[model samples]
Target: MIGFHFSNYDPRQSGKSKFDQLLDLFTQLLTYTSGDVTEALQWLNELDKKYELTDDEYGMGDFIDELKEKGYITDDEQRGEIKITPKTEQSIRKRSLEEIFGKLKKTKTGDHQTYKPGLGDEVSPDTRPFQFGDMLEQIDFTESIRNAQINHGLDSFTMQEDDLQIRETDFKSQTSTVLMIDISHSMILYGEDRITPAKKVAMALSELITTKYPKDTLDIVVFGNDAWPVEIKDLPYLQVGPYHTNTVAGLELAMDILRRRKNPNKQIFMITDGKPTCLKIGKRYYKNSFGLDRKVTSR
Candidate 1:
């Protein structure tokens, strides 16, 4: 017989090291600063001064050196500037993914299983009589053999088209998602800081699609007085602009992006804090922020 033993749990035994804790905080600050490495480090130092994030054994200087050694940041001597590397950008996305999705379990790629049965990689338990156009590989040999034995006898085994069993496979769909982000001044109004959360959600979703669902496509669009697409790598540096909301432009751009994608399933997700307040017509601007504008909303 097997036995089990249990021990007392200690919260202090958590696996994260001092550097990792600081790095997590630093990454979050970088998002708020729009990928400004110097500003993020300054904020970290301030937090350390107030909250005692580091001790004498492992100070902020040590963490900074570790960041350089790990290739997460690069310091240019000639230009007198410090910047985050692509590796750090990827790390921020991974952290955002984990924070929002809660550490997803590892699985095979393209695992979006659907109820509809068709040609797919994953086999389903449901089976049906073989159809005229069914492929030979889809036939369940075991069930077909059983059916043959039931139809005939063990003395002489024979199989017919009616005796064949076709196993159904779950259909996996690829999706083309257009994520529209509102960059109008309202996102940062009232000292609420709404754009940071929007940025995090975008980063998390982009990371999820790229890593877990490789076949899917994700396009990011930012809308203010106008709208345009941004690359996945530029998500960390997105900033809110001093412009009015032009949701129509964002939707039009999103639709244009989806039109170019070959995926069968398409969707649009918009993140905004205010209603439509601006519209453009033939080089002229129509703006109204008091309430919902009829012309803008109707458009």
Candidate 2:
């Protein structure tokens, strides 16, 4: 058998400037703080103090000034806090998408389905003879000209409706999606840090849907001992709580949210690492962590 070869990547093996390193550190800290600029900055300072990452000439204060100049954050006198800009939030979402899914596939061969060629409302690959009731815009001018040339000699070329070609197409409308994430205490069991990856996936899905499918609407919700909706920007700050998995509550909330959406094309995605262990019954919460609770799982 041939030996396998693998290469290791050193992130710090670069010619990045001090400012670049500071920006990278800030971006990393943003995830833990949920795009909160002040919190991220404080964490960055603490990290810098611990690791001596910053030099005397280029310190954290200078980095903050650079961040303001770079349009990443802005100070609000009204709120008495610096907030991350929309551009920074978008950048965070994109980074999360890249971290989880890599880059978007450029071809038609992947888990993500690219548009297929069909005779529907949009453009289709297979074309047929021009039929009645087809719009003039649908006619393939180049193909029609070629057909005319084949039917009549170039010396006396003539075109007719019979020589026209129409394109086949398919139509798709808006879609509504509900993304459910599990934030139970088990997500970080034994310091595995499962919630961070789940949060990245949520951000990735939201960014992908909102960008690729502009007409589509996406709602994200997290479930633990309870379930509630969270904004896309809040994904970076998602953390596991001292609670058990409540898959039933998550599913119920997803269905309830989808039911209110006007779009007929609606779906739900549940990301979890364990089975249901808790659910709310009227005013009381039922908890079961010993093993797989059949009643909770059944729902």
Task: Provide TM-scores for the models.
Answer: 0.87, 0.80
Error of 1 at 3 (Å): 28
Task: In angstroms, give how far residue 277 of model 2 lies from its true place.
Answer: 0.6
**lDDT by residue for model 2 (62-89), tens:** 9889889989989999989998887787
TM-score of 1: 0.87
Q: What is the TM-score (0 to 1) of candidate 2?
A: 0.80
Lowest lDDT sum, 10 consecutive residues, model 2, at: 110-119
Determine the backbone clash count of candidate 2: 7
Which pairs in model 2 have colliding backbones?
120-169, 120-170, 121-170, 121-171, 122-169, 122-170, 124-168
Residue 269 of model 1 has an lDDT of 95
Q: Residue 87 error for model 2, in Å?
A: 3.7
Top lDDT prediction, candidate number: 1
Q: Which stretches of candidate 2 lie over 4 Å from their true place?
A: 1-17, 35-39, 46-52, 74-85, 103-106, 109-123, 131-137, 149-155
